[model samples]
Target chain A: MLLQIIVNGILKGGLYALMALGMSLIWGVMDIINIAHGAFIMLGAYCTYWLFNLWGVDPFISLFLSIIFMFIIGYGIQRYLINLVIRATIFITLILAFGIEIFINNLALVMWTADVRKVQVPYGASNFSIGCVTIPYVRLGAFFIALVIALVFYFVLNKTRTGRSIRATAQDLDAARLVGVDVAKTYALTFGMGVGAAGAAGTLWAVLFPINPMMGGILTLKSFVVVIIGGLGTMFGPIIGGLTLGVAEALGSNWFGTTYENFISFTILVLVLIFLPKGILGKSE
Target chain B: MAQRGATTKKLILGILIIAGIAIPFFSGNFIIRFFTNTLMFAVLASAWNIIGGYTGYASFGNVVFLGIGAYVSAVLMEKGGVPFWLAFPASGFGAAIFAVLIGLPVLRLKGHYFAIATLGVAEAMKALVDNLEITEGNSGIYLPMMNLSVKAQYIFFYFMMMGVLTLTLVVTYIMLKKKLGYGLIAIREDEEAANSLGVNATLFKVTSFALSGFFSGLAGSLYAFQQGFIKPESVFDVGVTVKMIVMAVFGGIGSLLGPLLGALSIEVISEILTNYFLVAHTLFFGAIVILAIVFTPKGIMDIISGRKKFGINYLLQNIRDHRV
Candidate 1:
């Protein structure tokens, strides 16, 4: 039972951590919380759903189109609306994020109404059984993709020059200016990258969960919880945080009968704020 | 006897209070009920300002304390068969303890994390309350009351809201007098600098959060008492949280009159529009919030204080950084 639960949690956590990675990137490097991160994910899921249903596109093939579509939207949004307040206070940025979130939700309600959409791929729910544990294929595939993304992000930030400039600007824009990097482009790129990650997570989420306009609210909260527990800006923090949170939630529901499951993350969030302000890992990178 | 500005403020407040108290008399039963809901929301918005505006913590979880207060009052009144007056304080007690417990951790995280933590706590509380048997679960619980009337409820609820708003302003005035309030402002401006300057950032934040929680709980109890109904969805609501934060931000964070002015004026406008246009009220309010943030990032106080400089400065700043 323990092994099965642990495995289930790890699979879910990997995907959640990937979502957290997108959130953490915008927060850590871009210095904007991007409250609309989950909305972008919702949009991506819808995009994937339509492509799979209408165009005979597989989930994996449609992932590329979703990324491309989201990248343009993300870049345009950041360059136009978000950059206006890059020099403003964090409060302004927060409001901007919220304003956009409300706008998107309302727009989506007008366009699509409040219906739930499902993305049913071939054998979407197929699972393998081993020693009394069931592992779903789609969940496993999502986890594999999340791992791949994290590894690629790790390599880009660790070894590349543009990544170096992003790191430099995140640390200190003034210092980065002296070192000759386009801070504006870097910020936009970081935001685009964050949204791209959101797209990937949305595809995964579309496979397992139902999608709606306001679905972003809960995912946004989950990402924050994952980000907080993992610590800000830490590449591997989301992976650790996501797994811990997923398992703890699973355990909480098991022990306290699901009523306390939501409370567990919050209780842990409160504890993290009080005792582990720097996050559980005490590392950002 | 005519103290001019003071008398003017007192006159406006008196008229607003009278109008609020006389709401059920002027409108239909449904309108009366809706106005009551708006007034309840106003009280919540004002209570939120005590900590959010003053301390700058951006607590996205203020609804949790509201839930605590509502649950406490409802449980005591319905389950324990306590009177309205006594049950109200029971609500406060629950909120106070919850605020302290949750605030201890959430208040420590800075910036976005603090906001997210509060939101998580709020959402978590809702889910927890939803499944708890004591609160009657997702099906909801009905209040056992002794003749609850909409008119009588409005009169008392008016006083409740007016009283909390007055208390908030008075407490704010008192805090701003000495070094304690200044300590909070210092932390808001720069936490590390404030700490270096001998301000105990932790204590101040935790205390302010508790104070905010206490009053929000008070408002919640008043809400439950007035409605004779309490539910986890409305009590610990995300929409309520957003409204509070938006109200504070729209008026002028860090100012006493700002939140009150913002809540009352915005709500009054919403009420008026809803009276005439009904369904358009939500979309209109949404637009107002967006416009408020875009045009006046510093809020109404900033516009009022620096009316002459608004446009010129906006243009100047944009021109100076033409990278736009």
Candidate 2:
């Protein structure tokens, strides 16, 4: 039973890492919280849902399209709306993100009434047994996909010129500007990249869990927990944070019941803020 | 000249107070209900201004106090047979106690961390409330129905809420003019500097948070009594936080009249939008907030008070300052 719970947690953590990656990246690069992130994830889920329901496009195949589409939307939002208040006070930027979140969430509600949806496929229920342990195929597949994406994202960040520019901008905006970097463009790009990741996570989530327009709130909170736990800016932070949270949540639910999942996550967040404000892997200023 | 100006201001204030007191007599039941709700929003927004605007903590979980207040009053009235008058202030005390405890640790966090931590706490509180037996769990608690007629009930709650609003405004006005207010403003401008100046930053922040919680809790209690029902979702809704924040930001942050004007105007706009668009009301509200934040971060109060000259140039200057 313990092994089963651990395995389940690790798999769930994989998806959590993906969701947190974008949020942490945006925060690291632009200092914006992007409160509407979960809404973008919701939009991605709908995209996959519609693709599967209307045209029989597999969720795995539609993930690419959703990422691209969400990237554009995210880029546009940062460039046009968020950029206007990016240099304002922390309160202003935070409130602006919140406004966008409300807009997207309500727009979703109007476009598609509050109905829970999920994608169904032939192998969605299939599982493989190794010894006494049972591994679900869908979750295992999602886990592998999430791992590959994380690795790819890390490689791009470390190996590419654009990635270097993004890192430079994250570290020092004025310095990057002195080096002829378009800080504004980099911010927009970083935001778009983060949203694209959220889109990918949403596509996977649609296959594994029930979804609706309002599903973003808890997911957004969960991502924050992961980001805070994993430490900001570091590539491996989200992965570590996500795994810790997933295991903690799994154990918490097992012992305390499902209602306490939020309780457990929030407790960890508060404790981390109080005891380890810089996060586990975050470098002290 | 200054004395005459003060007298004229006092005269205007006196007239406004008389009109506010007599509003229920002349207004219809619907209008009374509307004003009561708006005044409650005003109280909440003003309370938020204490911590969020003045202290710069920007807490997103203040609705937790509202939830606590509602539950405390509801539980008292339902299980203990306490009267509404006693239950209301008791609820405020309950929230104040919780705020002091929670504020001690979380208030140490700065900037976005503090904001997110507060939000996380609020979500945790909601979940905890959902499972607790004393709050009746998810099924929620229903207060005993009042024996008064519908009009009387409306008028009673209206007056109760108005009284709460008056108390909140008076307290805030006095605080803003006193040492505590200056300390809070200094902390917002620079916490370390405030501390260096012997402002007792932590004490001021916690006190502001507690005061904010106190009024929010009272509003919640009044809300519970008016509705005759209390649920975790209704009282602890994030939407309540959003509305309070938006209204506070819309009118002006940290000013006495900002939240009052914000709450009244936003509520009016919300009512009008809800009537016409129904499903699209939230969308419009969100759009308006975004536009307002982008174009006028200082809020409408700045223009009304003539702190910033109102014209097309003002809008252009805002865009130039913020735009990349």
For model 1, how does the per-residue alpha-carbon lDDT over A29-142 read when each residue is reduced to its tens digit? 867888888888888888898898898789887887888787778887787767766776676677778777777666676667789988877798689998888999888888
Q: TM-scores across all candidates?
A: 0.90, 0.97
Instruction: Count residue pairs with overlapping backbones in model 1.
Output: 1
lDDT of each: 0.77, 0.89
Candidate 2, A204-236: lDDT as tens digits:
999999999999988888999999998887888
Tens digits of per-residue lDDT for model 2, B1-324: 445545644664587588778999999999999999999999999999999998999998899899999999999999999998799999999999999999999999999999888988888888889889888988989997888999999999999988888898899889989999999999999999999999998899999999999999999999998888878888988879988998999988987778888898899999999999989999999898898898888877676665556798998788778766
Q: What is the fnat score of candidate 1?
A: 0.37
DockQ of candidate 1 is 0.41
Name the best candidate (by lDDT): 2
Best candidate (score: DockQ): 2
**The 10-residue segment with the lowest total lDDT in model 1 chain A:** A276-285
Q: Pick the TM-score winner.
A: 2
Model 2 misplacement above 4 A: B1-19
